[model samples]
Target chain A: MSDAPREIDALIEMMARLPGLGPRSARRAVLYLIQKRSVLMAPLAQAMADVARTVRECANCGNIGTSDLCAICSSEKRATGEICVVEDVADLWAMERAGAFRGRYHVLGGTLSALDAVGPEELRIPRLIVRIAEENVTEVILALNATVDGQTTAHYIAEALEGTGVRITSLAQGVPIGGELDYLDDGTIGAALKARKSF
Target chain B: MSDAPREIDALIEMMARLPGLGPRSARRAVLYLIQKRSVLMAPLAQAMADVARTVRECANCGNIGTSDLCAICSSEKRATGEICVVEDVADLWAMERAGAFRGRYHVLGGTLSALDAVGPEELRIPRLIVRIAEENVTEVILALNATVDGQTTAHYIAEALEGTGVRITSLAQGVPIGGELDYLDDGTIGAALKARKSF
Candidate 1:
């Protein structure tokens, strides 16, 4: 019996589920839509609906697009032989923003976690292997997050693919470039010291 | 010549125009959708499209809805004879989160801005006055931001409806409980003193 619309409530609920947006922010966003119905809300809604209908995962690389294959996978110009593996879409987005890699990506969806009972099957491990053989991929870059589960998953994948004649690597981990030594915990300092080589 | 789609580029451009989002974030968001087409992107797009088609401004209170009037404006239970006037819907939502008032709202869309040449006509000032008579409004609470423009707008409204005898009030400006008095800026301390009553 509240004054708000059912649709608005649904939208708010979905928005609340998003990272960083809580019930309060969701309500604020919904109210803003109410006021800017013509210029902002309507257009945003339309875009959302359109994307929901047309978007699909790339059959080859798990990338999203309006077709069977994503834009990156479909593009011949991309360095297809080099696959950058990431834990989630968010990480993939971060990589893209950096504009450092000119290759396609493989989204594992998540990492191996014994606590959560997640395994390689839960991830796209088998599919990733199949894609390597199918696409003639040579280099597999592990761009997963620097978390315990993420490292465990990467190690498992590396072990599984040994003797496949494919080169495997990972994103270098240490103290972030702009981080202050005083701010870092003892664990990070030890890891950085241990990992340090010629550099 | 780029691998990205023209539609996607256009979409990114539109997203860049959103508040709190820049070109970089927009690009990242679009790329994310492309990578998670089935799970996230597709659903988001469809929702947007559906909303765009069905959404419209409520003719009565300017809230977004699928019909001529918003659910809040049309509800019988919400006929409390009190209208909370706000500079924008963001403020309205904030008020709703507080859940103190059970009244309907009037979104002015923006504060009266002289520097930007915004006037009563630019905002929904006339519509608000008209609604007061039609809705039998008893109290008109001014919930504008504590800015010079906001105060100017409130004063103008007060003068305009001098004979109507609507109880005009504002949010109390004072030290928030648990906030240290020493930490307060000069303006806040002055306002607190000015607004201090028979305490």
Candidate 2:
């Protein structure tokens, strides 16, 4: 009950629903937006409206975009016969930021969670299967998280694509770059040791 | 380098400028908004636009409102001759949430800061001075923060109203209701001890 006007309060409430913001931070953000109404708030509102009106899921890859196909999916140069599978659009964005993958991506929306009753149809796994033959994919890389649900999803996809003849690989498990051995968890340390490469 | 649409990228950049949000969190928030576009994002955009178009500072007290005078200033019942002076609109809102104060508030916008070259003229101090006489204020309660700048501005206001013949008081300093003695800082413990009241 900050006594802000109804519109401002509503904006703060919606902002609080965002992934990283709580009620307190939402209030701070709304205050900041009001303080810079013309320079920031108005433009932000316009941007949001534009995105809401135009943004849609990529019909081919399930990535977010302004058109039926995402930029990666539409780009001819990205048809490298390789498809990187991720559990969410955020991971796709992370891979793009890394700039290590020039191929297209498949966004699973989420991992397979048996407790949540999420099955193969709930994800983009079926679409991923169709894509392998349609695009003549030579490799399918599973880049899902290391969580239990993520591993279950990876294994399910691997088995699904077993007869498709496309090479299946998972992201290498190892200590992260700049990671210290002493601070590494036992599981990661063991994995890194087992997968040790020649200098 | 997230490779999101240009509009999304722009929105993320603006969102990152908000208090308590960085680039990574901004990305997460944007993705969340996109996911809940109809239920949350559209409404949030509309709310922001409405606030931006209508919201303005209360000319009398520097509080944010949709009208020239804020709700408190417009309400005859709130003219109790006891004006609470706070450093910002957020503080005024905090007091409102506490629901302890019946009188209206005077938001100074910010405290006088030597390093920042902020003086009485830069804030709403002059307007506050004028309000004391015009509103028949009998008491001015300094409810600013306990920071050096807040205290400095409070003292400066007290000195400025020397001949106004109005009673000037400040909020009491003591341990917070749920505060623990062991975790309390040295300065706070000292202040609480000095301001201790009979049980």
Candidate 3:
């Protein structure tokens, strides 16, 4: 019978809307918070609230931050001529973790998708173009996902910048160093075969 | 070689401290956010900040809220004679999804843990006793976890409230409906056997 309080229902509804949380999972998460009121729940709520209040989008590179302009953009050292372009923030963070690339980043937001009706106008493509000329960027790494949409967007960008003379490169494709041939699907096998190296 | 910016390291350290997140996962997650700044990272950061500013602890029940008290504790209609006492908010939320109980709740925060030096005073036990007297409650259901510490804490509370005259009960232990025997663990089977009925 109708057991949950009205307020609980509201909380559950909002939680269910989360990316990975369904109604059942949302209920469990809420209950866990109630039980760990002092330790887990209270702290989580506080953190959530704090982030909600102070977080904003960086105007230049589209990174998230407390200020209008993100720390990377404001930093004079990161204003190198090379700008690495990526499809998502996660990829940008990955490059940072690797500690390899010295230049800054330009997040593309997402790959262009004909199925989803997503276009260059919908992404940060225009802003990226402006940054290319204004920032005097020399090399642009097309660090997009391996998906078809990602490749399509990459090709489109490379074609558009034909006269700009900026060197464009992409992450190599082939058998992943750690990948087991047994685990790969047929399409992956075909891709790896086509991109095989002389070594 | 010192590759990443100093601010990046600081951010990674904080991320590693999140529950279910290790350094490896944190690295991956950070990378993801950076790449998808406009579509994902920016929005996620904004949401986090917004929640942080608005979130506060409930004065009465200790639930998370944007105001003084959470919606459940503020509603007078929820002051039913029954109160389900659970070890965590997650359990409370689970019960809510089941839609089985119609009364308010008492979140115990956590079970008594001698190893961690956690005691009744550290939990919401005192608050619960006060609620029983002030709210004129008739029933107090123990909905704690099945762990050893959880049961010990339950017995302690039951003894403490000897003269309180509140009816106490627990969820029945047995073979969960539609659960396969092969999938059932030893403890579940033992509980089901002990609580077996004359069928």
Candidate 4:
């Protein structure tokens, strides 16, 4: 079969490896880019190159930014003595989109997965303990996922900070504000029932 | 909100403009690329740049490749005096993937549409006519979509080529192979039944 040039085919293969795209979708995306080369493809290529050159993990928190320190880490106003620990940078961005937290964050990179051989040192766990004492942080919120590995990581961190004198908290377990009880899984229903409180 | 650095954010925005991607998917893709910088992202960026620098439309058939004449147009075996006409290059690629047709192709760019004010001059209808005589093409296959405008364009092309003595044809309408009859639309069912021949 007559295919696109080698460079175009290579691009499609790389794109198909992305999180949400497959081979078919990547082919469509590449064709669209080729068709709109002047208006879209050229600009996208330039943008990706620019980001590849500048974006880096923050030295303090692991948030992605152009400089060594991310914007949150560099800002003096975000030093609220509260550290929200998340498992991934995507979670950090989700929390930021909510716009309710003024304190800084500590991205763990990933949860402690025994199957994957991920441990405390593999993430930023030791850094979190150090930050709690050095920054005089009073609260360390374990905002990890509800999965087994997430809980294990949170528990590990909590146990490790036994004498650190910092308050530990987690996201409340309950039905989402607009969630229907009928659609919730059994685990979510049980957690919501156990954490029920007075109105 | 704590968005990524400006360049990273720009990259995500540009990615979101692709055919099958939205903002959420684009953000996830960007994060994946950043995480796999050395293995996947850098190579993808370079591939896109290389394609943007070299890929061009085939002057003869409108297929995308690295030179003025695409690979299909430059080949000798494909000059079989038959031309398959399609509305877009993606369709042309689809035909190539099927590996059933060995003749050359003529990409019309798009079908003629009165509502969109697309006339004969806007597409490659005149070019197809010129190629028929110059290339000694004996047959012209109309592979435009089964839409109203597609049919209109086909009829227009057939009439325009009436005096040229080339056999005109089109893709047949039918229940797709492995397609369940219950899920097909009425128009498809009607066409399939009407076109049914000796089993």
Candidate with the greatest TM-score versus the true structure = 2
Candidate 4: C-alpha lDDT = 0.89
* Candidate 1 displacement at residue A151 in angstroms: 1.7
Q: How many backbone clashes does candidate 1 have?
A: 24
Docking quality tier of model 1: acceptable
What is the per-residue lDDT of model 3 for residues A31-93, given as tens digits with 9 covering 90 to 100? Answer: 544444456544544444444455566788876666888677787877578888888666776
lDDT of 1 by residue, B103-183 (tens): 898888787887989999878888988988887888888888888888899888878777887777777898888989899
Docking class for model 3 is incorrect
- For model 3, the stretches where C-alpha displacement exceeds 4 angstroms are A1-81, A126-138, A175-199, B1-84, B96-99, B102-106, B123-140, B159-168, B178-182
Please state the Cα-based DockQ of model 1 relative to the true two-chain complex: 0.26
Candidate of highest DockQ: 2
RMSD of 4: 1.7
- The regions of model 4 sitting more than 4 angstroms off are none
- List model 4 lDDT by residue over A1-199, tens digit each: 2276778888998889988899889999998899888898888888887787777899888888889989998999996599999999889999989888899999999998889998888898888878888888999999999998889999999999888889999999889999999999999999999999999
All predictions: root-mean-square deviation over Cα?
A: 4.4, 1.0, 5.8, 1.7
TM-score of 2: 0.98
Q: What DockQ values do the models have?
A: 0.26, 0.88, 0.14, 0.66
Writing each residue's lDDT as its tens digit, candidate 2 over A59-112 gives 998999999988889998886599999999999999998989998899999988
Q: Which run of 10 residues does model 3 chain B get worst, by summed lDDT?
A: B1-10
Question: What ranking of all candidate models by TM-score puts the best one first?
Answer: 2, 4, 1, 3
